[model samples]
Target: MTAAERRASGSLAIIFAARMLGLFLVLPVFALEAARYPGGNDAALVGMAMGIYGLTQGILQIPYGLASDRYGRKRVIALGLLVFAAGSFVAAAAPSVWWLVAGRSLQGAGAVSAAVTALLADQTRDVVRTKAMALVGASIGLMFAVSLVAAPMLVEVIGLHGLFTITGLLALGCIAVVFWWTPPAPVQHANVPRGRLADVLAHGPLLRLDVGVFVLHAVQLAMWMAVPALLVQAGLDKDRHWQVYLPTVVASFVAMGAVFALERRGYLRAVFLAAIGIVLLAQLGFLLAARAPSLPVLTALLFFFFCGFNVLEATQPSLVSRLAPPAARGAALGVYNTLQSLGFFAGGAVGGWLAKNVGSAGLFGAAALMMLVWLLAAWHMRAPQTPKTAEEVLADEAEAG
Candidate 1:
């Protein structure tokens, strides 16, 4: 990467990290905390409070990205961050479960993920764009891991209200970074035509990626709905749950490194398939562990589950960007991200229902079933064509004309 590319990637990472930290910081702590409020004792209601952000984000992400095209990236992003901060304050002060849901939904309305991604695409030339995105992806993954560890401690120290205040401050911090860290936005690409809904929907490869993202996040949220409780039931203290998490996260890194090595050796498709297979195996492991009710057994199984989840979480967006056209990249990502958000909403609701009605075993069984479906869908998916560098593709197009 050139100096400019490095700067662009770093600036984007800072912005992405700040915005995402606010959202993810609450994930590990919310369900248990919200249960203390009125109506929060109901599992489904708590799930709603926890997952409502996905619903609103799913609805507005595309519109937000498209609006950025006309109104400019920084302006759209700044507005979204302001709204997100407002929602954070609402959530911090919410007294009832319904009010928490409302606040979460308001937070989702900020929905600038697609817009931010589009701006990143605009800033970097194609050859280095994937590397740039990898930085962003890694930032998000790191934030999720950090949240898993930090949220509980932070909650204990300052309470959930303080967490929300911190999130609001973080949003304002992103606004400052936008101006101080990033170069001025580029002139819009003349050849990159406006995104069309019909065309974006018709793109089969991108649709497959969309499904992959939806299933991925759905499974993620659903697992958390029950996994933490399962850990506590297994005699692991809530605070010490990190013991299981830390090791599993470390193992996932090792596993992902091996897969990347395979990809570099020209076996990308095999590695992708293998990752899905591992996820299926992990789901089955979760189901079996739930049935046995052994603490040691469940802990072992969770380590397996995270290895698969972490790998998939890191890889899916690269697939989406590879499949989508340059002109429609924003729209394609918008649709893909929306599906992911919906998964969170649906997963929380369904996971809670299954756990409440049928118990933890049933919840794991349902997640396993979803993974099974995703595996089937993936089996039929054609591997994406490797994308040409920006310079190469542009040269070819000019010569053809």
Candidate 2:
């Protein structure tokens, strides 16, 4: 990558990390914190508040991406961040669980993930795009780990409302980074053909990657619906939950590096499938651990889960960028992100219900079933070919015409 690509990728990765940190910060504490609000006692409503961001995010991702394609990535991203900050402030001031849900929905309405990712694709060359995406993925995983540790401590210091306020401020700060630091996107001809949503939708390999992302996130959100409470039951205090998270996150990063090495060695498909298998095994382990409920057992299981999660998170987007038509990259990513958000919403709502009605074991069982299906889909997915250069993309289009 050139200096400009590095700057763009670094700035964008920070922007992505900051927004994600805000979201993940709430996950560790929201279920317990919401109990103080009106309607919080209803498990379903609390879950809805937790997951409503996904609902709005799912609904608006494609539109945001399309707007980016037509207008410009930076402009769309700035607008999205402002909306996110507004939503964060609303969430910070919410007097009831339902209000928090509304705020969360607003937060999701700011969906700029597709736009940011598209810009990254635009800035980096095909040869280095995977590494750039990996950096972004690593930032997200690191943020999640940091949030897990920090949320408990922060909530103790500032409370949930204060946390939301900080999240709003963070989003506002990212807006500055975008305009001042990130490089401008290279201009393409106005008359150049762009990818149609229908074309991306009809593509088989892209759909398979979409399903992979959906199931990956769905299982993650679903598992969290129970994991926090389970940690409490296993003798860890809610405030001290980071003790488990900290070590597991460190170990997962180490494991993820090894997995990346396999991909570098041209074993992308094998590593991808194996990562799914690890997730399945982790879910199954969670189910068995629920019966016996030990902190050590639960920690080991979560470590395995994060390993799989980090690997999949890093690999999937790169595959999407490589496989999709260059002209429609933003739209394809929009569809991909929409599915990912839907998975988050579904996992939270359904997982909460399962936890409330059937118990934690049942939630894990459901997640395990989803992973089994994803594994099958991934098993049949062909490896994505390397991405073409800009000249190649234009030449291919010319040849087709």
- Give the top-scoring candidate (TM-score): 2
- How well is each residue in 1-401 modelled by candidate 1, as lDDT tens digits? 77877887788788888778887788777888888888988998888887888899899888876677666788988898888889988988988989889888988888888778777777776545556776786677677677778888999998777788888889888888877887777877666676665677998777877887788788788888888887887788787776777666666656566755554455657766677777777777877777655677876676666677666665576666666676666777678778888888888878778778998778877777877887888786666555566677899999999
Rate residue 116 of model 1 by lDDT: 80
Q: Clashes per prediction?
A: 0, 0
In terms of lDDT, the best-performing candidate is 2
lDDT of model 1 at residue 134?
64
Predicted candidate 2 versus true structure: per-residue lDDT over 1-401, tens digit per residue: 78988998899999999999998899899999998899989888888888888889999999988788878899999999999999999999999999999999999999999999999999987667777887898898889889999999999899999999989999999999999999998796799666478879999999998998888888999888899888988999998998999889888887776754566567889888998999999999999988778999999999999888888887788888788888888899999999999988888788788888999999999999999999988788877655565777899999999
For each candidate, what is the lDDT? 0.77, 0.88
TM-score of 2: 0.95
Worst 10 residues of 1 by lDDT: 259-268
In model 2, the Cα lDDT at residue 358 comes to 91
- Score every model by TM-score: 0.91, 0.95
RMSD vs true structure, all candidates: 3.5, 4.1
